[model samples]
Target: MSQAGAKRKLQLSELEELRNDAYASARIYKARTKVFHDKHIVRKSIEPGNKVWLFNSKLKLFPGKLRSRWNSPYQVQTVTPHGAITIFDPKKGKTLQVNGQRLKQYIKDSVPTEGVESVTLADPIYST
Candidate 1:
């Protein structure tokens, strides 16, 4: 009977040890995932007077597959401390504040064409 009690105690201790190890492994896995998620997060910055496009996430009943989800470019008026931006609409003359994550810098298509290099050929010498 004493031998049986000893064996049971040993089994209980091993079970406790396994439970502790499992908890530790879970903690380590959670920390690793947090680090990975933080690493992949993108940081965006906007300055005053910068034009940016806003993401429109409003759901429609019939969503178009090829339609662009971004809105027109808005001029930035000010940047708040907690990722909030105050933007101005030039056409409507209205201003509003929104999260910076919804905004991306606007790139215009009209690039300067004045500095293109041109090739010039010298006039051929007159034949005698």
Candidate 2:
């Protein structure tokens, strides 16, 4: 009976050691995955008065092969250091705050034809 009890004690200790090793393996895997995810993240910087396009992820549920998923340009109202930004929609006269990562700078092309000038990024210049 004493020998059988000793064997049970040894098996319990081995099981505990196996559990500890599994816990350590899970921790190491989590750390490595976090590092990999952080490395691929792209940082976006925006300033007030800049025009940006907002990504519209809600359109994914619908089927539109040629339709764009990004919304129209919105003017930046304010930017925060914690990657949050406030934007204003001129058409709706409404303001919205969103994550800076979801916004991308909008560049408009200016083509001048028939003595009329196009819109510029900084300011508009009229032709006489």
**Best model number under TM-score:** 2
lDDT string, candidate 2, 32-123, tens digits: 99999999999877899999999998998994999998899999999999989999999999999999888999989766567886766897
Off by over 4 Å in 1: 1-20, 59-61, 111-128
Task: Return the TM-score for each candidate structure.
Answer: 0.60, 0.74
Which TM-score value belongs to model 1? 0.60
Q: Which stretches of candidate 2 lie over 4 Å from their true place?
A: 110-128
Q: For candidate 2, what is the lDDT?
A: 0.93
Instruction: Report the C-alpha displacement of residue 119, candidate 2, in angstroms.
Output: 23
Local distance difference test, each candidate: 0.91, 0.93
Tens-digit lDDT string for candidate 1 (42-124):
88868999999988878355559977878899999999888999999998999989999889999898977899888789887
Q: Candidate 2: TM-score?
A: 0.74
